[model samples]
Target: MTVLDPAMVPPRDARAAFRDGLVTPTAGWSAGWAQANLLALPKDRAYDFLLFAQRNPKACPVLDVTEPGEISASIFDGDLRTDLPAYRVYEHGEQVAEVGDVRDHWRDDLVCFLIGCSFTFEAALLDAGVPVRHLERKSNVPMYRTNRACRPAGTLSGPLVVSMRPVPPELVATAVRVTSRYPAVHGAPVHVGDPAALGVADLGRPDYGDPVEVRPGEIPVFWACGVTPQAAVAASRPPFAIGHAPGHMAITDVRDSAYAVP
Candidate 1:
């Protein structure tokens, strides 16, 4: 079996592949396009989750939102129930299913939110010569739940989640500079060096996604992750919800440059 080079595929084609049952982390997929985190909740809980996102912008930078029962967004025309590489179903905060399609569980009252993903900035990081270890290793970017708590919003609260990338010592500043230009996608490093400060006791064991080698002398830099919403779902335990599996993102039609700052 041959795997497509996601980095070289077009966003629409990438999504089509996903709909066709192709499963892979989207880090380098559709190189110049923005990717988004997926969160679908019932109409009754939408307002609370929206407020949670507003109160925690860094970890939940929303790119687009769908009307209740709508399966597509302006920036994401693909079918929300089947276009992503994978989906997670949660009930009362406990994850109950991880599947490639959600149409079986889709509800008419579900409202979908598309949050900006750091993968939107990885192309920029590579262009600037910063190493993205997960991409190099053909693995998922590691994510951790931090001791830091996000601001609570109307029945929702959880610890902030962060994605980790290892950069060479000399390129740390460059990585920060490039990523800062994309605030819509969790811009800049929220914490760099000493994972202990974030309460990450082990680098090889991540709360979400797979761990990649940090390499000698490379420092692990942390960025606010869109997965924070899923963490919120687990903590707040609303009656029900659906989200994309970590690292398995919805490759949006929007270009990454759309989120870049001057």
Candidate 2:
């Protein structure tokens, strides 16, 4: 088990680790703070990207958008280039490289978008007595690309992506209630059993993150993922793009409650 130091519990401490070139996954970092997925493309196509996210609200819930060339969000108060654990640079829709920092790839014409992540509901889940198996197992939550298609907008379209958790049967209802309060962060599970229904053939082999064990009495619950933007970037083949590597998210300074509803 990787025992994190007490100093690492703060959001600033986590960001410092990334600044110091840490390439590990961002899950479990700054637990109460919201974590976001990132997407960057050229300024000209920014409208298309915005329209796409608006059209596919489930997978691409908008959290924050940046003006062209800006690297920091008012909510996070940090430079995106150095704050994330890893960045995936895509060129012509193909992932060209995954780097610890994106300073070299940053361009004046690029616009960054921050999307709400399922991690926002994690603290609430645990508080409500729901187990986050990935945290217990010390692994990143599993993610899959479903056959379900997202509504297309100009220059962006792809299959829906989902993040999975193994929820105990008894806590299923509680889980839904706890997460549904955070609509910006994917709200609730879209599918809860039968992975094949989402075109996921094997839960053991996920498209992203680590596989977690589903207890005998547990059902696999799937939530719309922020990573779906990356899938759209892949399918659309934008001339230039950058995104947080799977499981490595932008740990924002905002509180989870900031996006939650009564």
Stretches off by above 4 angstroms in model 1 are: 1-3
Residue by residue across 200-227, what tens digits does model 2's lDDT show? 9999999988999998979999999999
In model 2, residue pairs whose N, Cα or C atoms come closer than 3 Å (at least 3 residues apart or on different chains), thus clashing, are none
lDDT scores of the candidates, listed in order = 0.94, 0.90
lDDT of 1 by residue, 46-83 (tens): 99989999999999998898999999999998899999
Candidate 2 worst ten-residue window by lDDT: 3-12
Top candidate (lDDT): 1
Give me the displacement of residue 44 in model 2, in angstroms. Answer: 1.1
